[model samples]
Structures are given as structure tokens and as C-alpha cells.
Target: MAQLGSDLDATRAWSKARWRSELRAARRGVPASVRFAEAMALSNQLTSGRIVRPGQTLCGYVPVGSEPGSAQMLDDVADFGVRVLLPVVAGRGPLDWAWYAGPDSLRPGPYGLLEPIGERLSTTALRIADLVLVPALGVDRTGVRLGQGAGHYDQSLPLTAPGTPLVAVIRDQELVPELPAEPHDVRVTAVITPHRGLIRFD
Candidate 1:
């Protein structure tokens, strides 16, 4: 039984790795102009929709490369008087949080990410967020998210208060019917795309 479990774990890891590589390559193939436009549309949806409210402590991220949305989303959310918290990658452990002051408040971090510049908030800080906009390569109707294989968000998501909305940010095409899911995989509550806006699973 233990050997079978170990084999299953290896298979899942291999499947996840393939999905990450394929999705990332597809994202990178997108035109920059299209990406920008889609990002703007997504931002509009987030702001116009009731997903995030004013004065809410929302946790968001700065998109890198062809990832859906843009830094503008973070700024736009902040403009709504929402206190935005961006992730700060600390080694391979759970992510640390920090307030997003503005674009100027960000500095380049490891893994080609833009992290917030401020005192590191405890991992428990995620519990204070009214909503979380998580970065993902793909998400299924079942709310299974395909991250970049870093497990950063996976490690941090458990810290959020129960029932807190964890929204996955991905492109419209990336919203598929299914993806490989493991016990440790954190399912998203909703998915946001340029075309679909926000689709809630539960």
C-alpha cells in the first residue's frame, strides 16, 4: 500500500509538471497587446463587479509576463480604498504578505516576481483578507487550479479564514472542464477571466 501511494504521488507530480509547462508556454505565446487588453477588461470586471468591495482588505498579486491581469488591477483595487496585500516570496516556505502602496512600492524579487516593499506580515495575515485574487495558469469548473508548480499559494491559502473567497485569475481559454487534483491542492472558490468576468464554483 505504501509503495502504491508513493507511485501515485510521483504520477501526480509528473502530471502537474506537464500541465504547468504547457500552460505557461501557451500564455507566453499570447500577444502583448491582447494580454494588455484582456488584463484591462479583467480589471474592469473586478472593479465593477461586487467581487471586491471598498475598504476591504483584498489580497492580490502583480502579474508577470503573460499572466492574466496586470499591476493596474492592484492599483485599481487600491483606488477603491481597498487595502491590498501582495505576496512576498520567502524561500520555499509559505508566502509572506505586505501592503501594496503602489507600483513604486514594488521591487523585483526572486522568480521574476514583483513583491511589495514593507514589513513582512505573518503568514496568518491572509486570514484578514476579505478576498484573495490568486494567480494561476489554469482553473477548472471544479475549482481545481493549476499554478506555476511553485506551491506558494498552495502553502499560503490554508491560512485564509474559512469561507473567504479565493478567486483564481486566469485567461478565458484556461478555464477548462477539469484538471488533475491532489489532496494538497487548494481549490478556488471562483475564477476570473477577461471574457467571463467572474464565475463562482461554490
Candidate 2:
């Protein structure tokens, strides 16, 4: 188990480095507007089947640093009556979340991440969320997720209810056949991609 943990961390670090380089290259190659549009479409399709309904909390990510344009995706989801909650880097232990009222509610924070400018809404408060869209650099068809090596999402995912759906957001090509996984590495139930839409592992 120790060996597996060490190996997973090592592979995670390597994968993160490679993904950063690849993302930079992809940005240079792909049109910014096109990527944004495709991503928006993918997100919309993913949430379409699920009934967000008014008052349902949807845990989401803030589009900061190298994370994808999920901030915009949250906005669209919010418009659909889902109360969006964005993660705040509260500490190194696990991810804490805050309510995202709008663009004005966010402020730049550590590592360029944006968080709630006002009092943070405790992640525990949003425990009844119907859905949660996780941010990931890559994910495999079998639900193996590759995060940014910080393990924030990995640590926070397990806190959700036994059957809460965790969906990873990645590019179409980022969904691979397999990726290095650790016992602690949380796998998302489904993946949302620009061209492919929602892909369920089961």
C-alpha cells in the first residue's frame, strides 16, 4: 500500500507537469473562442439530464490558475436555478466551499484562485447538493481522475454522501484509457467533454 501510494504521487506529479505543458500548447493551437464555446456546450449537455431544480446546491470550481473555464460553466448552471458553490482553498487538509453569488462575489487569492470576497459559506452547509462538477486535468474511461497534484478534490470528494455523483471536467482528448491511480485517488462517476458530452463510466 505504501509503495502504491508513493507510485501514485510520483505519477501524479509527472502527469500534472505534462498536462501543464500540453495545456499551454493546446491554448496556442486552439482558438480561445472555440474552446470556450465547446466547453460551454459540453457543460450544458451534462447538466441537462439532471434536474438542478431551484435550491439544489451544485459544488463547482472557480476558473483560476490553470483550471479550465469552469467558472463560466458554473454561471450557466447557476442560471438554470442550481445554487453554485465554488471551492475555496481553506487549508491543506481538505477543500472548503463558498457560495458564488456572481462575478462580484469572487476575489483573487492564493495561487491566483478566486474565492468568495465576503464571508465564506461553509462546505458543510452545502452537503445536500444534488450534483458536483469536479475539476480535473485528465480522467480515464474507468473513472480514474488526474488532478493538479494538490489532492484537494481527491480529499474532498469522499466527504459527499455515498452515492453523490462526482463529474470530472476535461477536454475530449484528456479522457484516456487508463491513468495511474492510488487508493486515495477519488474517481469521478462521469466525465464531461467538449465534443463527447457526458460519458458515464458504468
Off by over 4 Å in 2: 1-28, 46-51
Positional deviation of residue 167's Cα in model 2 after best superposition, in angstroms: 0.3
Clashes of 2: 0
| Model 2 clashing residue pairs (backbone) | none
Candidate 1 lDDT over 36-68, as tens digits, reads 899899988888847888878999999998888
Cα-lDDT of candidate 2: 0.71
Q: Whose lDDT is greatest here?
A: 1
58, model 2: CA deviation in Å?
0.4
Model 1, residue 102: C-alpha shift (Å): 0.8
Tens-digit lDDT track of model 2 for 42-132: 6677468553555687787776544556567677777777888777887776777777889889888776788876566565644666788
